[model samples]
Each structure stands twice: as structure tokens, then as C-alpha cells.
Target chain A: MWMIDLRGIIPAATVVGCILLIWTLAVIPMNAHLAADMAARGDVVVTPHSPQDRKAMTGVTIAVKNPVIIAMTYSLDRPRLPSPHQVAVEMHNTIFTVAPTSRRSLVHHAWVTLSATLLGFVIGTTLGVLLAVGIVYNRTMDKSVMPWAITSQTIPILALAPMIIVMLGAIGIQGLLPKSIISAYLSFFPVVVGMVKGLRSPDAMQLDLLRTYNANAPQGFWKLRLPASMPYLFTSLKIGISAALVGAIVGELPTGARAGFGARMLVGDQYGQPMVTWAALFGAAITAALLVGLISFIERRTLNRMGMGAA
Target chain B: MTPATITARNLDLTFETNDGPVHALKDVSLDINKGDFVSFIGPSGCGKTTFLRCIAGLEQPTSGDISVNGMTPDAARMARAYGYVFQAAGLYPWRTIGGNIRLPLEIMGFSKAEMADRVAHVMDLVDLNGFEKKFPWQLSGGMQQRASIARALAFDADILLMDEPFGALDEIVRDHLNEQLLKLWARTEKTIGFVTHSIPEAVYLSTKIVVMSPRPGRITDIIESPLPRDRPLNIRDSAEFINIAHRVRDGLRSGHVDD
Candidate 1:
């Protein structure tokens, strides 16, 4: 009756195999066609052409066949979208030759945004937890603080970005701090709401047990309420980290800054280079995924240690 | 000699709902001697739970006083004199059986060595020694209740207040727990004040039965069990036990409430 768990290695190996098979099928004919087109355009002249070359060209053409051409025709017959091989080359150059500190490479911008995103997420989550605790414990705080938090999100980040930038400049606080503050502001509400619900989710019987033990306010909070909120806190934190990244990017939008992922997107927009903008976006997405994945891993381990591990 | 553990003097409790005030308990009085096994049997909404809450210091008696060993229940609780078992198992789903048992002791700042020894002792006492690492959700309902009982026993409290401890279980499981509870009681001599709705349970497990009725919830009858002190599972089928059960039923059906 024992079932084998194939979560980690087996699925990964299967995906890799599928990817390799698709790659092989996609690239060989594409390489042959591109080589023929280059020769026709006089980009490369192969001297002393023989029957072997002609046979090789026919084999590649026949393998691609009529269906591939029909598919290409339906796709508007534009220049072929860059294949996996081309993307790999671009990725390699971006990582190595492109200056790590330069706005030309996505890695540089990703690092710039990542540090600020993490800092803002930590600050926001801490603030959110504190606020949630206050709101849960005191009616006045719930009435006063919760409404303002909800209203804060009513103004879109796009509209708010310039105003935030301008206000920070007026206060003589510019650069990283302004961006981090925006990130924190955007990230706090979800954590507050999620944690408040979780902390209060304990059933009546459980609360009664704690009361019967003569647990005071602090004891009950530490021993029962806080532990109950851990799952909620971690889930909201994952969402908050991504929101903080969005905030950091949005924070860079109105500024004439020389760094960060959003700054690169701005530079790309000014220069009319869509590839560079897309690359920077991909970099930011990967950074956010990695950060959230790391937090989720830690959460799972902590929960496992607490005997609340996944079923 | 041991002390007179718990005493309630004309205790009354009222809940202030938005609709109006709901009188939960009216002029209830009782005394529990040290190491005695007492059961409070009553119908639904009969303030049996409210009385237990007053003794546990979770709720205050509105117009009277309750004391445990000559001090207020709250004071005695701070001194770590009592353990409470609710109707639901009340074991934290996030903690292991061992961890749940260690919780109250941990809060009270017991040493690590002492905590471990007490945990082991209680687990063995409740026949859950190997289940220390299992979560409450992983165990059966019967086992979860036993673990909760073990948690109460872990702190070595002088008094145990149980509100409908076996009310949720099947007859087989309930009988099993009752026998084990008797053994634990015999071994530790911890005074127990149990609340239940079952007449047979009251007769089987109690030294003193306090029968109660609804509508302002007053004590109707108090009967001393005539069965021998050392009870096993076989005792439940005995003529003496049936006589006590019938007596308890009579008390319940008599519809007499002395307010």
C-alpha cells in the first residue's frame, strides 16, 4: 500500500527530457535554413560547392516539409522569433561582457532592485504585524488605522509615483529611502489583514483552554495567538515581497535615476529598444520568484518543525 | 491531612447580552474535599459549565465567592494548583502530543529536565508513551482526549476540573477512558470536579453526584455513590451501579429545583 513520492527529481528529469527533445527538433532545420539564406544574400560564400552540400540542403528542406511552411505563413511570415540558441547566447553575453554596474545588463538592475525590495518587504511586514496586533487588541486603533490603510490603495501607484517622488524631494529624502518607503506602503495592508484573521482564527474552545490555564494577555498572545498566525504571516509575506518589488519599480518610474530595473526600462523606452526593456522585466520577475521561493522554503521548514507539516 | 480543595458559596453568574441580561447560574453552592471524585450531572443549559468556569477562574461569579484551598480560584491558579479539561479535546493542532503536554509547564517556567520527566510520566500514565510526536489531528478522537487529559496531568496539579470530558465519545471509548481515569485518580489522588449529561457516567465515575436542572439552573439532588472505591470496567454492569444509575435518573426526572 506504499506510494512512491516523485515530487523532486522525477518530474524535473521529465521536463528536462521534453525540453531537449523540442530543442533538437526545432533548431536543426532552422540552422540549415538560416545558413542557406545567408549564402543567398552573399553573407557567406562556400567555395567549391559539391553534391554533398546539395543533398544536405534537400534533406533539411524536406524534413521541415509543407506543414512547417504553412504554420510560418499563418504567423505572418516575419523574421523568425529568436530561438533558444539565440536566447542562450544573449543571456551569456548579458551576464559576462555587459558591465555588472551598467544599465545595459539586466543583472545590474536586478541586484539594484532586489536589495531595496527585500529591505522594504521586511519593514512593511514588521509594520503590518504591529498594526494588526494593535487593531486586533484595541477598538480605537481598528477604527482609526484600518480605514486609512484601505484608502491608501485607492490612488493608483502610477498616479501616486510622481507625487511620492516630489514629496520625498521636498523633505530632502531622495534615492533608495523614498523607493523603499513606497514599497513598504504598498506591502503592509495585505499582511495586516491576513495576520489579523489568522491570529483571531482560534476556536472558542481553544481560547477557553488558554483562559483556564490562567494565561495572562502576554502569555496567551505568545503561546497561542502568534503561533496561530504563522501560516498567515508567511503567505501574506510572499505576496508582500512581490508587491514591494512592484513598488520599487514604480518608485523608479518618475525619477531621473541612473540605476534599477525600472530605470533600465525607462532608458529602453527613450531609446526605442524593446528587447532591453523585456530583458530587464524578465530579470525583475526572476528576482521576485527567487526571493518568494526562498521565504516559502523557510516557512515550510519552520512549520514542519512545529509539527504542522503538510499532509 | 489534605485540604478542603474547592468551596463555592451561593455563587451566581449573569451574562450581559445586547438583548438583555441572561442569568446563567442562580445561588449555586458546593464544596469539594481534597482527592475526591465529584461529578456534576445536569440537563442542557443547566449552568454546569458556568460553575466549572467559575471554579477555573475563567469566569467570575456575579454575586458570590469561590475559593480553592482557602484562596480565590484565580490566586490558586497563579500558584499552579489546578488543571482543566474542556469538553473538546483542546489540544493545539500545531503541536505534538509531547509539546502540548509541556505547554502549561513551559509557561509556568519549569526546568527542562523536570518538564521532560513530567511529560514522560504523564504520557505513560495515559498509555500514550509512544505517541509523543504525533499531532492531535493524526490521532483518533479518543486518543486526542486522552492526550489532553495527559496534558492536564503533566503539571501535577492538586485539582482537575473536567467539563464533559467523555461526553463526545462512543460508549466503548467512554468506558475505556472512565476506567483509565479511575486508575489515574487512584494513583495520583488528584481531586476531580467533572461535569456531564450522562446519568450512567455520573454514577460510574463519581463519589458525589450533583444533579442540576435548567431555567435559572439550580441543584436538584446530591447523591453519594454506593459502589466500592476501586472500580473497573466490569463494575458498570453490576447491580449496585445500576441502582445508582436509576437513582440519578430519578433525580433528573423528578423536576425538582431548589432555587
Candidate 2:
């Protein structure tokens, strides 16, 4: 009955129009009210007045007069959620006007996170697949290594971040190395678990057929197990890529690095500049989504070529 | 060595499961002569399938020796002494029908050109000519089994081990394939070891029927058929075929009741 009711083009159009109307009614009034309130607040003076009170007052009045500055400062005070217009205008001004080559710009920050995310994904996936093979094939390694990996995750990365940065500094490995390590750590476990299950997913009769053909271990792995595991591997890789982005952002936290999205966040917090921090956050999230989407695209193409695409 | 055919010397196999030790086969000995057709008939778990697997080197005898050709089954396996077909066709789902048939040949290191030619030849043998590019899931069960048998025959193995290859099919399809199998067997002259629970199937197909009993699975009778080698589907309705079928049924009933 419901499907029949939805059959005509007029009904479908009416349903979509109703949804759009509801969303606009729910969002537009609140956004307009918030935008009006933002216009009354002035931006903060981060430079501490430069030993002149009149100059500081002038800066405050100019910030209140600027609608973009007012919107940006209002968003900083309320960081849990910001309206779309507030975020988009901040994105435009910082990315297009304020030092385009600077890492503070959303575009530059996106590239920084993207390069680290891709590098870490490759390293983590390779390591995870190898570990899964060792765990699946060798009982001793499965027994000894799996417990250690499980335990490593229990010690929170928040506490471990400082130790990692200090240790890397002590050994002269700075910048990307420590950050990538954090990404690798967050990403590898899911890949290992997913791959191990996929590699062993062949049914009993299938294994028997391989045996009847007198296939050796390597031959069976190549001809059957590896192909069977591709879908699961891709699934784990998608999860791993997103985790690696989180790790990369977290890795920047303790390094006190001058660049990267995480360092920009710290800088914004120290000076109460909420616009810069919110901009960096949006940049990280977009980078992560793009990485996951790219992996999913490759996964679809690979599975299609292997004849295991979605039916 | 041309190999002393396949000689099983008092083979015994027992399985220790959660329900305690289940003796699946016991004190069975048989010889499959070069180019002979032998079928094993029994109730389920009477060790006919177990015995077939033992010959294929998939299972080891608990207390006896099985020699394929003249070597251990495992050694003969490496030498490609036999090709096996399971109860349900075990075609690789990911591969095309042609690719499935080419598997054994590929394993034996046949070149691409030779593999293609042999695949085409076997496809023609099994009447699967136009379905080469289709995957196993695209075919009917009977056709998939035919593709499986083609796979077995692709490498030209001298011995064929089939475990109820037609048991799942309807009688009409079964009869059709039986005729085709007989023609193929006669044409190729490959020795076959078949396992079936059907009395008519055994009588029509085998030169010798090895009747088996359950529990401590043992062979109770070895009945040789009197039917001539050149027989057809209508032969099943003949007096000679009926007589052989009656003997097989009696052998099965006696074996079942004896325990």
C-alpha cells in the first residue's frame, strides 16, 4: 500500500518538498537568531593591547563592525556546534585571504593530514596483513603476539603520546615519523583481525578440493585464500584509514609542533582564538572522509575486477 | 613401474569424535585392475566415501596399507595417479566452467596453449562446449558435476574416483549422465572407483560391486556383474540387468541385516 502510494511523480515530489520545508523551518530561524547575536560580540585582542588602551578599544570596535569577525568569534565561544554559515565563512576567509601558503589555511592543513594518512595507511595495512598471516599460520606466534597487541591498545594513546614524542626526539626521529607511528598503531589491529578471519573463510569442502589437487601451502594461499580475503581486507582498510587520521591528529598533540591541524588547535586554545581551532577541526574531518572515500572507491574497483562485487 | 594397479590390504579407519570412537571402515581389501570399473555400495557412513578418500590420499588407513599404482597413495598423488569427484560437485565458484576444467592441467604445468586445447577437448567430451565462459553458479547441478568430471579428465589421469557423483540428481538426469559416463569410460578406458547407495546404479555401472555394512564398517560381499561391457540405458530394463540389480539388492539387505 505504501509503495503504491509513492508511485506517482507528484507524490514523490511532494514528499521531498515536505522534507526540505521541515529542514528549513527547523534550521533557518535558529541560524538567523544566532547570526544576529554574533553581530553584537567583538573579536578578542590576542596581542594584549600593545601598552595602549585606546588602540585595544579601536580593535574591538572594528571587530564588532566586521560581520565575518563577529561570526568567527561567536563560533569560538560556542565550539560544541557551529552553524554551517559560520564555518563556511571562516573557511573562505582563512583559506583565501590570510596567508594562502600557511598551514593555518584549511587547504594547506588538509594536504598535511592527507599525506600522513595515506602513508600511514599503506604501512599499517602491510604490517597488519603480515601479522595476520603469522597469527593464522603459526600457533606459537598467535599465542604470543595476539595478547601483546590486545594489551597495547588498553594503554590509552593520550597518555602514550608524550612518551612517543620524547622517545622519537631522543632518537632524532622527528615530525612525521612519530605521527605516522601513532597512525600505524591505531590502524593495524582491525586489519589483522579482519584478514585472519577472511583468510580462513573457505568452506571445508573447498579445502578438500584443494587437497585433492595436491596443492601446497603457497599454492593454496595464492589460488584460494588470498582471493577470498580481498573483500574483508578492503573493509578493514577503510576502518584503518579513518583511525590513522585520528592517530595523525593525536600525534601532533604532544610534539608541540608548529605545523599540522592539531598544533593549530593548541595554538588557538592558548590564545582563545576559536575560529582558527574550528577551522582546523573541519579540515581534519574533511581529510578523513576523503581518505575513506578514496579507499572505498579502490575497494569497489578491485572487488569488481575480482568478481566479488556487490550483487 | 606400470604400477600393480591399486591394492588395498585390509584397510581399517576409525574416527575419535565427541561421541567416542566411531569405526568408519574395517578390514576391507580390494584390488582395482587396470581399466576396470568398481563400485562400492552401502548405507550411509558404511565407509564407501571413506574408502574413496583413502584411495585419494585424503585419509590414511588406521591399520592397513593402500598402494596406488605401486606407491603409497600420497606418493602416487604427487605422480597424479588419480582424479577425484566428490558427492556434490566441488567446482570453484569464482572460476569459469572452462577455468574449472583447466585447474588440474594448470597444476601439472600444462602450457597455456595446451591447457586451452585440453579444456576444449574435455568440454566437448562432457557436452559443455558453449558454457565454457560461464561460472559454475550459472549452471544446473548436473551440468556443474559434468564440468567437475571434465576437470578430473583434463589431466588424463588413469584412475577416476567418484563418490556418488550423480546421487543428487533426478532419475532422468542421472540416467542421461550415466549413459554419457559409460561412453566416456569406454572411450578413454580409465579405471574408475565409484561409490553409490543405489542398487540399480551399482548394477548398471560396475564390473564389480563391493557391498558394505555399517557400525564397524566392513565389506560383506563382492558381486561381479554378468552384463556385457557394451550396454545402454534400456539395458536396465533387461533380464540380465534385473538379475544383477536383484543380486546387489540382496547383497545390500543381507549386509544391513547381518549386523
Tens-digit lDDT track for model 2 on B99-208? Answer: 88887776677999999999999899999989998877779999999999998898888999998999999999998999899999999999999999888888888888
- In candidate 1, list every pair of residues with a backbone clash: none
Docking category for candidate 2? Answer: acceptable
Tens-digit per-residue lDDT, A284-310, candidate 1: 878888989998888988888777776
**TM-score of each candidate structure, all chains considered together:** 0.83, 0.84
- Ten residues in sequence with the least summed lDDT for candidate 1 chain B: B250-259
Question: All models: lDDT?
Answer: 0.81, 0.80
* Per-model B-chain TM-score: 0.95, 0.96
lDDT of 2 at A277: 82
Q: Which ten contiguous residues of candidate 2 chain B have the minimum total lDDT?
A: B1-10
Looking at candidate 1, what is the lDDT of residue B36? 85
- Which stretch of 10 consecutive residues in model 2 chain A shows the poorest summed lDDT? A45-54
Off by over 4 Å in 2: A1-80, A94-100, B1-4
lDDT of 2 by residue, A176-274 (tens): 778888888888988998998999888877788777778888878877888878889989998999999888888888877777788778887788666
